[model samples]
Target: MGAVATPLLAEERVVTLNRIVAVVNDQVLTQNELKNELFAVRQQLRQQGIRPPSEEVLRKQVLERLITTQIQLQQAALLGIVVDEETLNNTIKNIAAQNNLTLAEFRDVLQRDGFKFPLFREDIRKEIIIRRLRQRQVESRISVTAQEIDDFIATQKAQGNINSDYHLGHILVSLPDEATPAQIKAAKNRALAILQELKSGADFKQTAIARSDGRQALQGGDLGWRKSGELPTLFADVVMNMKVGDVSEPIRSASGFHIVTLFDFRDSERHIIRQVQARHILIKEEADDEVKPEAQLKEIRDHLLSGGDFATLAKRFSDDIGSAQNGGDLGWVSHGVMVKPFEEVIFNLRDGEISAPFETQFGWHIAQVLAHRDFDNTEEHNNTRARDLIFQRKSEEEYLSWLRKIRDEAYVEYRLDD
Candidate 1:
């Protein structure tokens, strides 16, 4: 009887440590998980120089985010979406490279910053899974037609704010799908109240942290810089007339009522592409050859520098048959037209200045810059930009709608206080 009582006591301790915070469908979120997420969020807020809200307010916000994220994860599992181990490792390596660290060094840095390396890796995996899920579910469904692109471009031109960019702060008082008139009025009234607070000099970020339902609520509702064409049609209409520092009235949309503050605005300068007229002679690497490609190209470059005819030498020995016949003339090349290694070598060369032998994926090359120009590509740029912006605007709208629909359908039961 005493041994049985001892086992019961141990089981009670385990239950106490792994107390349930929330239940979503078939899974439960534990208290420890919530605590860890809360700690991470506080650290992030501090790093961003934003004061963390009161614990009570933040806990609710974090819990809601956790629930939504859990729902997305469940859906991802159901749809057979996963991040392979190799892909996850490669992503971590890329992140480390971006920060100028090796994988081991990155792990050390995480440890030094008080983050468990295993936890960080899992977090990255989850982020990748969620991103892929969004791509598969929301982004794949959106489309922008040619007529829409044409209309978008024309509208931007007529508005005279085609080149304008806006940095906005947003808050959404959300409502359920097919909400009743009473719910609509309630949400509108709530949005209006929040707007009045902003107008009366309340801190927009703090207010958003406390009340907003937008995806970026935890980030203080800040919707970083966006071109005019990238804004939702509803937001574009209201924002075009807004002055910097002005808070907008609640704008209605399918998701909910929104309030936005124009934090900053700027005009993009005219589109001018830097074009480099360059040419190169390539010597494709051959495993059977005793001479290495780079060494061979170096000898050729020395000959050209020693008063040899470039066109004659290129036509005689260059491996690129297409350009070799044309005296190795590549014509005018823009920034993104060539591979990175090739562009780096050619773009940095002065007119008539030849590069030493360098290796790209196509083997080895020696390049010469003929001339440079700043070409006005405004019309072409605008057309491409318009198409992209229309796609972005549509994607944002659809993603928000999709998110709301999923949240509405998910069965979430909170046991935070219990």
Candidate 2:
């Protein structure tokens, strides 16, 4: 028998131990890397209560997303770009403050979300790097002339138009993502049930507290007056036509079922701010990790309750920079001017009455409404409007330009056909 010649060609692809996940230049993406990012992604989605694909599917998606993101970031780094730690920390602090958590509490939240601190820090780092790269590389190149801003404003005003805004409140009931089809149906049914109850003389607030899964549940599902367009299309549609004290039927959304109540409909209400010449002392709620701000707020609350000068105390103790500078004066603010909770209280207050200390996205505030006024357009107002228009136009141009450059320069490939 003749000796058989050996075939050098392998019939199949062999996986290499050296290939952890996939390497882009020197950056090696590992399973652990994908896991960390995916953990963060799932945490964010979970907070929104959004339903996504299975963990396996999400892992694949996160891996792809990170890889694409890394490409953009790498290109940015090549331009000798970076973000300052102070700015990044402040950004995180602002986000935490929006959720009413102090820095420590916010850290706890990220920890509980199954993310390592380094993972979160790196997430922020990359975001800042991309942002700085975009600003330095792209945004700095884009500009809108002052004349353009003026022209846009004039054109808008020539339409005899005030920017359209709606003042309405809502009651929302959300369902978990892991919910079954029956559960979704049940959620909708419960929303309908709430509507029926409201129509049958049940208190809207009471129903909301008992049934809503959203954060609005705490305030009885009172969304407390947002612009008409700010709401989801479905919710916005029903509320726009309805008069005050109206209740909506079950409104379906990806987040689950929603029901809205229109407490008041004020068009151009935002432009004509109902100003309350009020002073306030704040009392931040005391959590163990956040006692100082809280204790300070409580002391202020006690003093106000005991008859200290609201304005005087506010100037000294209130942390509201704009208002504190003016003796805790929030100059005439439109419907959406203040945070939702504070706005509700301000609008509800009759002039000269002090409110009970109320907590908002900010630390707690105890506001006093000295007076209320309708809006007037003065030269100052027009100038202020013009400046705002300029900022908005410039910011948008910069933001869009930044996004386009990153997205266009990104090199992405999909291994899975889907």
Q: Write the per-residue lDDT of candidate 2 for residues 312-374, one digit (tens) a residue.
A: 888887777777867787766567566788888988888877776677877878788888887
TM-score for each predicted model, relative to the true structure: 0.89, 0.43
Using TM-score as the measure, the top candidate is 1
What is the alpha-carbon RMSD of candidate 2 to the true structure? 16.9
Tens-digit lDDT string for candidate 1 (374-412): 999888898888888988888888877888889899888
lDDT score, residue 213, model 2?
A: 57
Residue pairs with colliding backbones in model 1 are: none
